[model samples]
Each structure stands twice: as C-alpha cells, then as structure tokens.
Target: MRLDQMSGAKLEQDGSSWQAYAEQPLTFQFSFGDLQTNQDKIAVFVRSVENGQPEAWVQASDGEYQLTLAQPGHYTFEFKARDQAFNYSPVTAVDVTAIPVPAMISVPLLGEVEVRIFQLLVLFGSLAIFGFGYVSFEIVQHRRRIVAAVERGYNPYISGEPVRRVDMFFGRHDLLRRIVSTLHNNSIMIHGERRIGKTTLLYQLANALQEVEDEEFWFVSVYIDLEGTTEEEFFHLLMDEIAQTVRELPELAPEQIEILNGLLNLHLAENQYTDREFNRDLRQIIHILEEYGAVQHRGCQVRLILLMDEMDTLSRFNHLIQQQLRRIFMRDFAATLGAVVAGIEISKEWERVESPWFNLFNEIAMAPFSTDEAIQLLTEPVRGYYMFEPDALDFIVEHSDGRPYRLQQYALEAVNQMLHHKRRVITLADVLVAHELIQLSGQQPKGSWGEDAARGELGVPQTPAPAT
Candidate 1:
C-alpha cells in the first residue's frame, strides 16, 4: 500500500517517494490506500536515516497512522496494510526533515528584539540595586562611626556662654596686654556690640592681673557684674565685691583682713549706702593694702582695678547718678582705683563735651576678632584630637566674620556634626550642616556690628547680657 493522504506538514511527491518538511518538531497523520479486506489492519514504523535502524511496526488505528519527530533530523516513516489472514503489503515510505526554530525567535511574549531588551533591563536593574544597597550601607556605617567618636569626646568647642575655663580661652593677647598697660595709669571703657566676648575678656583680665609680678604696683582686681542693680545699691554692691575679692587675696595678712572687714562693716550699710561711704571705704582699703605692700614687699603702691561688666546699666541711671559715678572716678580715687568697664555703648549722654564721663576713660572699641585671632580660637581648643579641613576653616571664618561668639557657635556645631558622623576631620559640609542646625535652633549668625550697622538694626552698642 502507498500513502493516499497526509496532514499537519506539507508533503510533496519527489519522484516515487513522498517527502515532508517542518520548521519545528514534525508530526503528521497519514492514511494508506487499500481494498476493504486489506485495510482491515494497518501498521506504521519509524527510523532515522543516519542510523538506518527500523523501529518495530505498530498497528494503525482506524486506517490512519500518526507520527511524531521530536528531534531535528532526517527520518523515514513506513506504512503497511495487513489482512485478517496476516498477509502484509509492501512498505510505503515517506521522507521527512525537521528543522528546529531558534529559541529566541519563538519565545512567548518576547520576540528576538524583545528578548534582548528584556535581558538588558535585567542587567541594569541588578546593578542599580547593588549600587543603592552599597551607598545605604556606607551611610549607616558613617553614622555609627560619628556616634562613637562623640562618645569618646571628639568635640571640644564651646558656645552659647562665656568661656569660664582659662585653658579654653584663646586669642585677645594684644588686647589683654593693652588693657593691662592702660590700667596702670588710666581707666578704660571697652565698648562693643553684644556677644563680642566682652565678659570673657573680663574673666581673662581678672586672672592675668592676679598673677602680675609688677615692682611698682600691687594689683587688686575685683570683678563686679553690675547687671540689674539700682542706683542706690551701686556703692553697696561695689564694697561687697571688694570685700569678697580681698578676702581671697593670698598675700593679705590676718590683721589686714580684719581691718578690711571693719571698714566694710562700718561703711557698707544694709540700705541707702552713699557714694561718700563707698569712697571712704575704698580709700581705707587702699591705704591698708599700701601699708601691707610697704611692710611686706618694700614700697609697692597698691592699686585696685574694678572690672565692671555690663556697665550699660549705668546708662539707664539718671544723669545725676551717672555724674556721681564719673565724679568718684574723676576725683580723689582716680589715682588708687582704676576701672575697666565693659558695656554696649557709654550712653549718648556720656558723649557730651560737658558730661562728667566725657574724656574720663580711654575708649577701646571691642572689635570682632581678627582672622588670625579667629583661627587660633577655632583650632586651639580641639587641636590634637580633631582637625578642620582648610575649606571648612575658611567657611567658618568667612561666615562668622571674625566675631568670637559666632566663631565659637559655628565651631561647636561643626564638632557636633563631626561627632555625629564619627569623623575626626571637619569639612565644609560639616560646617554647613552646623549652620543649618544653628538656624533651626533660632540662633542664625547675624554677623557682627558692621553688617548690623549697615542694616540700621544696630542701635547703640551694648555688651552681651550676663549668662543666666
């Protein structure tokens, strides 16, 4: 029997044999032409052309045979018809060729172009995820390092208050020297805008005078904060500060202490102490010191320096009270008692030619720190432990405008940032972060008097209020 019909793959007659070809794995149905008696049973077999080994014949069902080719190859299919008596006809062969379709060309939902695009997307997506994870991990590690550094005391900058420690005090050397030299003969008025380190300078001056080894004069430096004092209580407060300071003098004899206490008790009243009483009490104290200096150290004259801070309060007093204060310094006490008074401005009243305070003091305007001084202030305290990058240092100096208080504030915040990141080096980025923090805390750096003066926001200059 010969094949009569075939389906699924294109079949063509090549000479006497039938041929078929398929792009994918080949499968087809075929039927043989035979008489009814011969067609009672049919069988089919398959074999590879390369191997030439035939498979056992299997009976076809219902006069039709189905064939499947799973691999790409040349194959032959043989069909036969068998009678009930068991006689079989000659084999009818068909040659078939199966060619595989490339996997990329036939992929579901992804053609050749789509498949390549998908592969690229996956590659780039994986890389982006890895990069993001790495950056996030580094940020976390940096934060941990900063926290650890801060706990270990990496920060050493001071802000918001006067520097009480002498070790942490920096710069102002020339200013200090000038003030000391001026105090030998004349009183000084240190005038500056707020937060310009007026009080800090006062503290330093106190320490410096206490350590003086002068041959001609013995210095008795008394610091008095004249904030919130009424005019009537001024003399009482002055005497009270003088008594406290003298009591702490290491060179004072027991009898000298007793003499001072006696004078204080006699002239410092519980209420209504007068300027006369203050003058009398100061005169006796100086005399006592002079006597002690003469006997103990051979003829050194004693001088008392009143380091009066927040002297702007004096401006609020009536002109009579102001004149009374000026007269005290202008009269008999001028030689033995000198004053280094720090204030915002010496009230416009003192600027008058006829005013008692006019020409009384050698005024020294307390300007902002010089660039060199600011550098010393910023770096000296944290020197050996942490450092600032050059750009960061410049940023602070430029932004702070050499104002000591602003410099400290900026440095303090920068250290805080360094501590947070556990970095030993302060960068410009760190200072910028510190600046934002300061502004967030409502302490924006307003620069110093020059800027303020330009804006007309600078009223008469004033010392910073005392730290609460």
Candidate 2:
C-alpha cells in the first residue's frame, strides 16, 4: 500500500494566534487513516525561520502531542507517521504564530531611577550651558578691550599697508637719513623682497622732505604707483603728473613751468598722440625738467624728487616702455630730478632682466630691524599702554628676525592674545600662543611654519603645536 494509505499525522488542534496573560501551550494530533499495516511511531518536528530550531522532537502513535516554544514568533511543525517495517508517512507541515504576553509590566520597587536620571541630565546640561556662556563672555570682553585700545590712539601693527604718517612709522631713521643726503647726489633705489615695507619708506621720505621744505627745500617729492598700468598709460600718466606738479609748485620760475608745459601739453590736451609720439614727448619733457627742476624754494635750488613705487610692475610690458623708463632715469628728468625708485628684487643681480640701467641707482637695500630698533618699534607708537615683558619683547624680536612687516604682525597678534586672555601685561607665554594661532591660520603657499619661524615670519611660533 502507499505510505499515505498506511498512516498519516495530522495538525488537528492548537494552531492559531492568541493573546494570553498566562502560558499558552501548542498541541498536535495524528491519524492512521485506513492504514493496512500497523504503525510504530508518530512524531512532530518544529522549526522557526527567525528563531531557528525548537527545543524538542516527539515520537508517539495515535496520541496527542504538545510543544512550548522558547519565544514568541512564527514556527512550522512537521507531523509524520512511521510503521514497524521502517516505512514513514509523508511530513505534513503547518505554520503557527504565537501571540506574545501583554507588554505592560509592573515592578514594585525601581528605587528613585526617574529622579536620579533627571538629576544627571540637569547636572550635565548645566555644565554645557556654563561652558558656552563662559566662552561667550570671554570673547565679548576681548572685543571690548580691543575697541578701547583703538579709541585711545593705540597704533596697531600693520602688514602690507604702508604707514603714511611719520609718527606712525618706525625703525627707518638711518635709512631715511642716508636717503636724505643721497637725494641731492644721485638716483635712489629702494628694493627688498615682497612685504618688506619698501612702500612705507618712500612715503616717509616724502613727508620728511615736505616737513623741511620751509628751511632748506631740496626737492618736492612726487610719488607714483605704476602697478597694473599698460605701457602707453604709463607714459601719458608720467607726463600728466609732471604737468600737475609744475602747476602746483608756485615756487618754480615762470620759465621752468613753461618748459614742462611745452613738452607735456600734448598729453594734458586731448591731442591723440600715438605711443611713439608720447614716448618722444616724454623724453623731451623729462630732458627739460632735468635742466629746470632745480628751483628756488628757500634761496637754494630744489630738485623734484620723483618717487616711482612698484617699478618692477612695468617690466612685464614691451621693451619700449622699459626703454622709456631707462632713458628718463639714466638721463635727466627734473634738473637733479631726484629718482627714488622702489620695487621688489630690483637690487638683486638675477632680477635685472629688464635693463642694465639699474646700475645707475645706488642701492639702499631695505633690511629687517636690529634688536634696539625692534623694541622701539614695538613700544614707541603705543607707549602708554601696559609695559611689555622684556622676555616677551625678546622673543618677538628673535622670532620675527627684524622683518618690519613680520615684526608688526607679531606684535599686533600678541596684543590681541593679551586682550583675549584679559592680560594686563603681554607675556612670553601669550607671545607663544599668538604665534601658534597665526601660524595655524597662515595661507602662504611657498613656505612652511618651521621655515617661517626660522626666517622670522610674523606671528609664527619658534616651537611646535602641543599634544593633547
């Protein structure tokens, strides 16, 4: 007979989902459906998909079976029948889902858990709030101090922007002194690396000459920045300035003013002169100024000191512009047309690609400050404020290595740190902190922090960042 005809197991009861407060048990029943032979055993096997195999299997015949699952989930029960001849009925599987016990539970004594959790949250939240407030208060106080410093004529250390006032400028007395004496003798060249205060010195020189213009007027200083101008623009602008200068100086003789007027009239007028015509007129105007620029300002004749700043900016143009400048500087402009030319690397042998007439200029190479000069620089402008610690001053001077711009940057940042920490006197520690902060913020591409510190880059530390 077929196995189905011999015997079979059945899932006749206990297969459904139910909610229970007490233990819920599952039961199964088997059937020997018209079997011709006797059956030895009947069994049930249970397995779960999510929860894996159930605890037990069973063997019985024509009897009820029960299973208690370990957890609430869906399960499958396989019911089978076996005969004494080792024949078995086919497995009949039925799925059942057990309903979980109600979610509500009660504990008689949780013992102040809610109160303790509230207390912990309050304590941490208070700390976080206090930390934020303290930092904010510190920042506000810092800003107020800086504002007060500014209000009281606190001269800040400036980088890149040249100091226009003589009172604000520092550490260039001797350089100015030499240039003062040299202006009457020959053409002047003020050259240094970028951001080295070349422009500021030129400004101060003009101020010096004007200040003494009453007693022994040597030259009326004329400053022109030739950055971002085309060759044609430079020539026209040069001539335009010459005309304006002649008109402004009442001390120049009528003949002297007329000479400049005749040559530069082509430019000041709407006359459409080509680049070559402008150059030709420029040469003539400058040649006349070379003869007559020496004027009676205070009994003695004064040369018009032509201060050309950022002259290297012109070298990127065509050779015609460069040649015009060379002729003007090398020949004559304003009698002893004193030329105080300032540009980056104009003194270096390698950067002389523009012209050989650089040799005509006596080099007044811009340099960093000495220790005494550096101290004066730090203290002189903002004298009445809190005294600087000698060690702090020494540290700044040493680290900055006398670079004017770097020195100012270091001092200003250190002062800022003093304000941040509510410090009365700037200390060496504050200096170090300021140095680190500024170094971390530096954006220069070509140099590293270590290299800058060694070379005296402004506001960079002589040491390293600290480890947490």
Badly placed stretches (over 4 Å) of model 2 are 1-155, 213-217, 246-299, 332-334, 349-358, 443-468
Local error of candidate 2 at residue 263 (angstroms): 7.8
Top model number, TM-score: 1
Among these predictions, the greatest lDDT belongs to 1
lDDT of 2 at 283: 61
lDDT of each: 0.71, 0.61
User: Can you give the TM-score per candidate against the true fold?
Assistant: 0.61, 0.54
Clashing residue pairs in candidate 2 are 289-334, 289-335, 290-333, 290-335, 334-337
Score candidate 1 by lDDT.
0.71
Model 1 C-alpha RMSD to native: 28.1
lDDT of 1 by residue, 343-452 (tens): 98774556789776888888888887788888888887665456889999899899888788778778877876776676788899989988887778777433232322
lDDT of 2: 0.61
